[model samples]
Target: MADQYAHSGEDKRPTETPAIRWEEPPEGPVLVLLDQTRLPAEEMELVCTDASALVEAIRSLAVRGAPLLGIAGAYGVALAAVRGFDVDEAAAALAGARPTAVNLAVGVRRALGAYRAALAEGGDGRRAAEAALAAARALHREDAEASARMAGHGLALLDELLPAGGHRVLTHCNTGALVSGGEGTAFAVALAAHRAGRLRRLWVDETRPLLQGARLTAYEAARSGMAYTLLTDNAAGSLFAAGEVDAVLIGADRIAADGSVANKVGSYPLAVLARYHHVPFIVVAPVTTVDPDTPDGASIEVEQRAGHEVTEITAPQASVAGAGGGIAVAPLGTQAYNPAFDVTPPELVTAIVTEEGVVSPVTSEALAELCARARRTTAR
Candidate 1:
C-alpha cells in the first residue's frame, strides 16, 4: 500500500472522515459507521436504523476501538430512543454487545441517563429522544476533544523520553482516525510526531490472527504519508535487539484502576520487549478507557474469539473463499487459542497518557488522582 503512495505534495494528515455519525433521515434516526471489516480494500458505510443492526456492527467489529465504541454505543442508544424502541433494553443489548471495552457501557449509560432525566421531567418520548441524541452528540464531541488532547500529551511525553528527536516507534493493532472521533490514541501521537518532523519510522506490527496493523494502521499511515514499514509480530524482537525501536505505543481497550492495560492480543509481548530493551512503552487513551471498578489486570475480562479466525488465513490475494469466507490454513478439526486481547501489567508500562494527563510509573494512586482531577474539572 505504501508503494502506491503518490508523493505529489498531497496533504497527508489523515483525512477528516468520521468513523461514525448520527443521521436523521426521513424514515428515522440511524447510526452510520464505516465498515471496518472491509478496510484497506473497500470504504463501505454501515447504516443502522435499529439497535440490533448496531449491535451486529459492534460484534462484527464494523465499528471498533475503545473511544469509538463508546461513541457508537451512545449513538446506538439515541437511535433506539428516536426509533421508539425500549431505551433501557436497547442500551442493555448495546452494552453487552462487546463486554471487554468498558467504554461501550459507559457511553450507553450516559445517553440513557439523559433520556431518563428528560422523561422524568414530563417530556414526551420524542423530547426524551432529543435529550438522548444531545447526550450522544456531547459524548462524540468530547471524544474528539479527548483524542486531540491525548495526542498533545503523548507527543510531549515522547519528546521528554526520547530527547534525541527522530523516533522509531513500534505500534500494535490499529489506532488512527478510523478508530476514534478524531485521530486515535497511540497512532494520533505518532501522527503528531510525524507532523512535527520528529518521527523517523513507524514499525507496524502485523497483529496476527487479525492483521489490524497491516490492514488498518498501515492504510492510515500510507494515507498520512508517514514513513512506515510493516513487519510480522515476531520481528519486533529483532527490532528491539538492534535498538531500532525507541518506543512502543499502543491503545487500550480497558485500563484497570491499577493501571494494567488490556489491549490487542500482541500488546503484552511488546510491553515485555520494551521493558527488556529499556525502551519507553506508552499507552495512549482517553481517561474514559480507565475502569476504576476493575481493580487490576486479573479482574479484566479477556474476550475469546472463534477459532476459525486463527485457523484460517484471509488475504486479498486469495482466489476463493472457503466454508466461511476464509481459506483454511490449519488442518481440519484443529483447535486454536484466539484471545481477542491480553492484559499488560502496570509494571511493564512506562507511562499512560490520557487527555487528562500522563500517569508515569502507572500506579493505582496516579490513575485514581488523574480520574479524580478530570471529574472535578468536568464538574466545573
Candidate 2:
C-alpha cells in the first residue's frame, strides 16, 4: 500500500507546482488549480471559469488546505469581477463554498471590500475590478511570507523545547507546499529541521477516509528527501510507547479566540496521546486562521462530509466490477458519520505557532493578546 502511494527511496526534492494561480486566456481570466483528489497517480489541473465551478472544486476536494482555500477564494472573486459577473453575488458564493476555514471568508471579504471602496471613490467598473485583483495578489503574497515566518518561529520553538539535536517528529494530514503559498505550516518547520540536520525521522499518519497523509504528505516527504515512514493512524501509540516520537506538529483549519484548534479529524487523538506522553503537541497556522468572534470550541461549526467517502474505497488496480473505482466497503444503506474536522481544546495543545510567534501554555488571555497584536499590525 505504501509503495502504491509514495515514491520511496527518492532523495531529490520534487519540482514545486503552484497549487492555485490566476490565468488569463483570450476568453477571460480563470482560476487554475492542481487537482488534489487525483494526486500521487495523476497530475491534472482544474480550470474554473466562474464562481460555481470554483465552488464545485472546493466541495470535491479538487483544491484544498485552509491557506490555499483562502487564496482560491480571493482569486475567484477577482475572476468574477474581471469577467463582468456580479461581484457581490460572486463573493457570497465563493465565501460559502467552505465554512470550516475562516480564511476563505476573510479573503473573499477583503477583495470585495477593496472593490466596493474603489467603486465608491468614483472608479469605473474596470478600475474596481483591478482593485479586487490587486487585493487578491496582496493576500497571496502575504500568505507566502507568513508561511516563511511561521516556519522560522516553529523551528525555534522546537529547539527550545528539545535541547537535544536529533528530533523525531510525528505529523497529521497534509501540510506542505501543496497546502500553502510558501512551504507550509507544521511541515515547513519539519523541512527546516531536515535541512539543519536536526531531524531523525518524520512519522506520517495515514489520515484515513481521505488518506491525505499517505497520498500527499508521504509524497512530499519523499520529494524533499526526508527520512519518513508512513504508518496507520492507530500505530502512533506504539511509537510513543517506544519513545520514538519527540513531538507532534499539525496545521489548523480554524482556531477560536480561546485557542482551541480545529483540524483534520485524526488530529485531536494525536494531541491526547502527546499530552499523555509529555510530548509537545504544537498547532501551526497563520494569524488569519484565528477567529476572535468564535468564543470557544463549542461555537465553531464542523463540516460533515458525504457518507460515501467513508463507506466506499477507491482502488484503481482492482479487477472486480466497479472495484477499480469506488468499491463498497460497507452495506449499501449503511450510515457513516463523517465530520471533516475535529476540535482540540487549548488545554490539550502545548503551544500554538503562528507567523507572529509562539504561544506556549496556550490560554485564552495569551491567544487574545496575540490576536490583538496582529490586528494592530494589520491596521498599520
Candidate 3:
C-alpha cells in the first residue's frame, strides 16, 4: 500500500493521469478511478466505496482494459473486506461484472485466496482484511512491472520485424497509460518506438460504437507529444491498400490456449487487413491474459453488450434526449448486434508479445509454454 498509484520507471510524460488508484479517506477506504467515459473532454474521478459500485463502474466501463480490470477487481475485493462486507459475495460480484476478461476473475480469486488463507490460519477479520489489501497491492505492482517488460519485448519485436528505423504503426481501440499500471499493452510498444525516434506516424482507428481510439488513444498520443492521426474504422482498408501501415499492434482482453486473441470489437478486422497487406499483426499483453482453460478460439465466450450501444451515441457530455443514454442515431426500436469484443485466430496473428518474450508463428504449444514460464517465474 506504499504507492497505491505508483508507475514503474521515470515519468516520461508528466501530463498523463492514472486511470485507477486506491485511497484511504477519513471515513473508509475507496477505489478511486478516473472516469474514462468523460475522457478528452473533462476529467472526473469516481470513488467506489463498495463492491457493487465497482461492479457498475466495470459494467459501464468507467474503468476498463483487461489488465486494469484485473487490478480493479482485486481492489474491489479488498474494499469489501476492509469494509466488513461478505468477502465471498464481493469476490463473486466483482469477478462476474465482466465475463470476457480472464484477468478479472483471476484477480478476484487471488485476493479472495489471500483473505481466506489468512482467516484459516487463525487470523481475525482485521488481519484477513489486511492480507486481502496486501494481495491487491502486490497484484497492482506486478501488473506495472509486467507492463514495462511487455513494452520492452514488444518494441524489440517491432524493430526486428521491421528493420527500417521509421515505423508507421496502425492501432485499433485504446491501449495506453489510461488502461494499465504502466504505459500499457499495444500502445506502450508504439510509445517505446516514439521515444526511440523510430515512430513515423501513429494511425488511430476510431473504433465504432465507442470510439475509444479517437477519444482515449488520441488523447494519450497528444499528451505524450507523438505525431498521430485519427481515421474512421472502415478507412483502415484504404490505409492498408495504400501500404501506409508498417504494422498493426493491439491489446488482448483474453487469450485462449490456442493463441486466439479476444480484444476490442474491431481488432479482428484489423488483423485480417494486416494479414492481407503482408504487415505484422502483433498482440501485446501480459501473460496473465492467457487462459489455458479455454481450449480454442471458438470456445472463448465473447460478451454481448446491449444493442443501444450501437444504435445510439452515448458520451459523458452528450445527454440529449434519446432511447439510449445519448441521441438516437438509428430508427426507434431498431435492433443491433453489439458484441463487446471479437476473436482473432492465431493463424492470422504474426506474433504474440508478452513480458516473458515474443512468440512468432503462434501455436498452442508455444503459447502454453509461455504461460508455464510465467507461472514458474511467479512461483520462484
Candidate 4:
C-alpha cells in the first residue's frame, strides 16, 4: 500500500524552520508577526503594529490552526499593549476574534491579568507592554517545549502499542512545525520517530474546506524528507478498513474537563473508525489547551464556518479528479453547516498525550493528575 504523505515528498529536503518569533525593535516595542496566508509557496510575515492587524490575522485564517492561533493571540495582546493600547480592551479584542479554541482565550487572559497587575501599581505604558510581551514570549517558548514533550509521550505510547520495528501513523490536518513553536503536536512525534529511525510512513489527510494536510503537512513533510502520501477525507475510511492504519494521532483545539476532545471537524469520525479497527486514537495538545472551566464536551463552543468553505475548494495543485468537478461541489443557495470543529467523547479516545505524559482512561482524576505532573516537570 502506498503511504498517504508520499505525494508531498517531491522535495528532497526541508530548507527552513517553521516558527513565529518576537522582534525587539530599538525604539518601538517588541515587533511580532501576523503570518501571511500563502505558505509553502511563499512564506511571508506580517509586521504587526496594532491590535486590528492581529484581529484581522486571526479572523482571516492568516495565522490559524489551534496551537498557533493561541500563541498568536497571546502575542497580539502583547503587541497591543506595547503600541500603547488599553491592555484590557486589547486582550478582549484578541479573545473575541476566535471562540472555539480555548487556548486563544486562555493565552489572552494570561497576558491581560499580568499586564493589569503591573498597571495597578502605576506601571507606565512601556512597562506594561514589556511585561505583557515577556509573558507572550514566555508562552512562545513554552509552546515549543510543549511540542517536544508531546512528541516524547506520543512516541512512548507508540512504542508500547506497536512492538514492530517501524511505526506507521495516520493524522488529520497539519500539525507540524508551522503549527507550533517546536516541531508540532502529532506531526512532531512522527518527525521525531523518523529521526529516531522508527517511523515507516506518514499519512496526511486532505482536510476539507482547506487542505491543511495536503498543502501544509505535505509541504512540511517534503522539507523533512519524510515518506508521506495524501488522501481525500473519504479515503481514510478505506485505509482503516484495509488495516493499513496503525494509529491515529491528531492535535486538539480544546479538551474538556472530562477529557472529551474538540478537534478538526473530521476527527470525531476517525475516532469512531479507530475503535472499529482496534487502533489507538490519540490527541496531542499542550496543557494550556485543556480547559477545566469547560466542564464537558457539550460546554465547549464550536465555531460555525462559512458555507463557502464547503461549497468551494482551492489548493496549490488540483487533484487529478478530472475537470468541471473543478468548481464548487455544492449548488448555489444550498445551506451548509460547517462547524470548524467537533467534539469526541473520551470513551472514543484511547489516550490523550500532553507534553507532561500520556494519560489513559481519560478520567477527571487521570487528566488532573497528568496536568499536575506536567506542571511539576516544568517547574523542576
Report the lDDT tens digits of candidate 2 across residue range 313-366: 763234433322577888778888999999999999999999989998888899
- Each candidate's clash count: 0, 0, 0, 7
Candidate 4 lDDT (Cα, 0 to 1): 0.79
**TM values, all candidates:** 0.95, 0.94, 0.96, 0.90
lDDT values of the candidates? 0.89, 0.87, 0.89, 0.79
- Candidate 1 has an lDDT of 0.89
lDDT (Cα, 0-100) at 62 in candidate 2: 79
lDDT of 3: 0.89
- Tell me the spans in candidate 3 whose CA falls farther than 4 Å from its real position: 1-16
Worst 10 residues of 4 by lDDT: 1-10
Residue-level lDDT of model 1, residues 91-188, one tens digit each, is 99999998889999999999999999999999999999999999999998998899999999999999999999999999999999888888899999
lDDT of 2 at 18: 69
Provide the lDDT at 278 for model 3: 98
Candidates 2 and 3: which is better by TM-score? 3
Pairs clashing within candidate 1: none
Q: Which stretches of candidate 2 lie over 4 Å from their true place?
A: 1-15, 315-325
